[model samples]
Target: MNFEYMKNFMDSLTEWIIPGNSVVIYKDGKKVFEYSSGYSDLEKKIKKTGEEQLYIYSCSKVATVTAALQLYEQGKFLLSDPLYEYLPEFKKMYVKDGDRIKAAENPITIRDLFTMTAGLSYATNTPAFEKARKLTDGKMDTRTVIKCLAEEPLLFEPGARWNYSLCHDVLAVLAEVVSGMRFSEYMKKNIFEPLDMNNSYYHTPNDVIISPQYIYEIQDTKNIVELQQKEHTTGVVKRAYGNELVFGENYDSGGAGIITTVDDYAKFAAALANSGTGLNNNRILSSATVKLMKTNQLNEAQRKTMNWRRLRGYGYGLGVRTLIDKAESGSNSSIGEIGWGGAAGATIIADTEEKVALFYAHHMLNPQEEYYQPRLRNVLYSCL
Candidate 1:
C-alpha cells in the first residue's frame, strides 16, 4: 500500500507530461493513492482539488452501461432486443448502397449497439460517416438520432465489423424508454445516489459553473503549445461531427456525457471492482450482473479487424471493453479486467480477478495520450 512511488510519479508527470487535474488509484475498493495537479481554471488561478470535478467525456458510457445492466437484471430488456422494439424509428433503417442508402438485410439490435457493431458512427471523416452525420441532424437522441441514421446506411451490416459510433447515445435513450424513467434520474436513483457518487451528473446543473481549461496542441516540430480555452456558463459541451452542441435538460446520452470528481468516480470503479456493491454497503446492481457485464462479447473475427492497433482481443460488452488477450493490451493481471476512457483524458479500469481499480481524470481531449493502462497494470500486479 506504499504510494510514495506513485506520488513521485504524479509529481514528475505534472511537470513533464499533461498537467493533470487529479489522479487516484483504488485497490480493493479503497483509495490508497491520490494526487491533483494544475488548475481547473488557469485564468482565475482556480486550483484542482480532491473535491473539484471534471467532465469525463466517454467515461460516462460506463455509467450508461451500468444503468442498462441494472435493467437487464430486472428483466426489463435483453441484449438481443431489436432497436426498433424500443425505438420503432429504427425499423426502416438502411445503409448507403451507391448514391442512395439501401435497406439493410436485418435490423440493428440492442446487442449491436452494446458491441459497437451497429453501422451508425459519429466520426464523419469517412464517406459513410459523413453521410451519417448529414442525415442525423448531428444530435444523439434516440428517435431523432436513430431515425436520422436510418436514412443513411450503416458502415457495415450489424455484427459484421467494429466501428466506434453513436451506438451508446442511442442506448441511453433506449434505456430510459425501457425503464419508464428519465435517463439522468435512472442513473441518479440506481448508481450515483446508491454509490454516494454525489458530484457526478449527466446534465450540468445551473448552480455549478463549469470552468474553462486549456489543451496543448502539438506542432510538427514536436513542440507542445497551449490551445484556446472554452468557457461554460451552464451545461457541458459534447462535440459530434464538426459541431459543438449542448444537451437539453431532458437529453441523456449513453455514449459520452458524464461529469464527476476523482473521489466520486473512484467509488464507482471500486464498486464495480467489488462486484456491484459500494464500500458504503449499497448494492447498486447484483454481483451476477456485474460479472456478466465484464465478460467478453466480441467474436473472434470482429476483434481482429478493429482499428485500434494496441487493442486486439478487446471486446465491447455493455459499456466496458473486455480483455480477450493479455499480450495485446499488455496487462499482467486477470483476463476479466474491463474498462474504458473518455474523449477528454479521463480513464478507469477495474480488475475483477485482482479486486483492484485505477482512475485518472483530467480535462485534456487527447485520446492517444499514453498512461496507466498497460503501464499501471504491470506496476499494480508486480506489487501484489
Candidate 2:
C-alpha cells in the first residue's frame, strides 16, 4: 500500500480537519498501513496513538449483530420469529394514523429489526421518541429502554419502510433474553475474546483512558471544543465518555455505545473481510453467517425509503451497510463492502472482494463539515 497519500490525509487532520484522528488499514489479514495525527486530549496535551480509544457509536450495532448471528448459528432464534415472542412488550404494537393511533396490521419480526424496517424511530420530534427519552433518562437499563420503545407507536407498518431506529437495542435485549446473559457478557465471550479485541469494550473500563470527545460548532469551525464531562443524549441512557459512561449502571446500547481503538476495530473489520476468521485464528462467526450478514437485505423500494445521507450507494444488511451498486452509489468501495460509522466521525469498512479492512476513528461531535468517509475511501482505494 502507498503511504504518500495517507501521509497527506493525516497532515490535513493536523491542519484542523476534525481535531485528532487515526486510520488503520489491513489487507490479506495483515496490517498494510496505519496513521495517527493530532491530540487525543488537546487540553491535557495527550497525543493520539494506536492505544487511544474513542466511542464507536452506531458501529457497535455491527458487533451486536455479530453476537445475534452467533446465537442464530446455535439455533437460539429464527430471524423470522416475531419479536413479541422474545419480548412480550412488543406485542400489539400501534402505529400513528394521521393524528390518531391504530393497531399495527402485523407483528414486528426479528428480521424487521435487523433490516431497520420495524418503523421504530429515534426522531426526537415524535411524541413516542420524546416519551422514550423521558422514560430512559439515563436510569433504565437496555431491556427497560426496549420495553419503553415497544410502548411507543411506530411511524409506519412493520416492513413497510426503512428508518434507522432503536431496533438494534431491541435486538440486544433479545440477545440477552435468549442467551440468558448480559448483553456485554455475551459479546465479550462470543465476539471480543475470540477475536482478541482487547481494547474494545461495551463500557469503558476504569483503567482505560478514554480519548476526550470534541464538539465542532459552526462558530468555531477551526477550533475543536473538548467536552470535560460526559454528556447524555436523548433515547440513550449512558454518559457519552469516561468509565462512568461505560461501567455505569445504565443501558448497554447495542446501537451506539462502544469504545475502541482504530487498531482493535481494524481487527474486527479484518475478521469480517477474512470471511469470519480473525487474525488470532479464532472463528467468531461461521462463513455462511458472515455472508448472510454482508448480504443486502433490503429491496429497491426499501432502499429508496432510507433517509440517511451516507447511504447513497448502499443497502441495509443484517446490521451493517452493504454496498450494492457502487456506480449508482458513486462510492469507490467494492460492491460487497460492509461497514458502519459512529455519530462521532469514526467509521469501518470491510471489503471481502478486495480483502481489505479500513477503519477511521475520531472524537468530533456532530461534525458539520462535509462528509469525510467517501473522500477517505476514494483516497485509500486509489492507493491500492
Best lDDT among the predictions, by candidate number: 2
Q: After superposition, how far is residue 201 of candidate 2 from its true place, in Å?
A: 1.5
**lDDT of candidate 1 over 260-305, digit per residue (tens):** 7888898899988888888898988788888888887777777665
Give the residue spans of candidate 2 off by over 4 A: 123-138, 219-248, 368-370
Candidate 2 C-alpha lDDT tens digits along 1-384:
677787687666555446678899999999999988877776566888857877878888888898889889999999999999989998899999999999999999999999899998865354544455577674657776677667788999998988888888889899999999999888888888898988888766789877778765434233324221213121112135442223135778888877888998899999999988999889988889988999999887888897566678788899888888888678887887898887777888888889999888877766432356766777888888
As a TM-score, model 2 comes out at: 0.88
262: Cα error in model 1, Å: 0.9
Lowest summed lDDT window (length 10), candidate 2: 228-237
On the 0 to 100 scale, the lDDT of residue 60 in model 1 is 83
Q: Sum up the clashes in candidate 2.
A: 1
**What are the runs in model 1 whose C-alpha is more than 4 Å off?**
42-46, 98-100, 123-143, 219-249, 371-373
In candidate 2 the C-alpha lDDT for residue 233 amounts to 23
TM-score of each: 0.84, 0.88
Prediction 1 TM-score vs. true: 0.84
Report clash pairs, candidate 2: 313-329
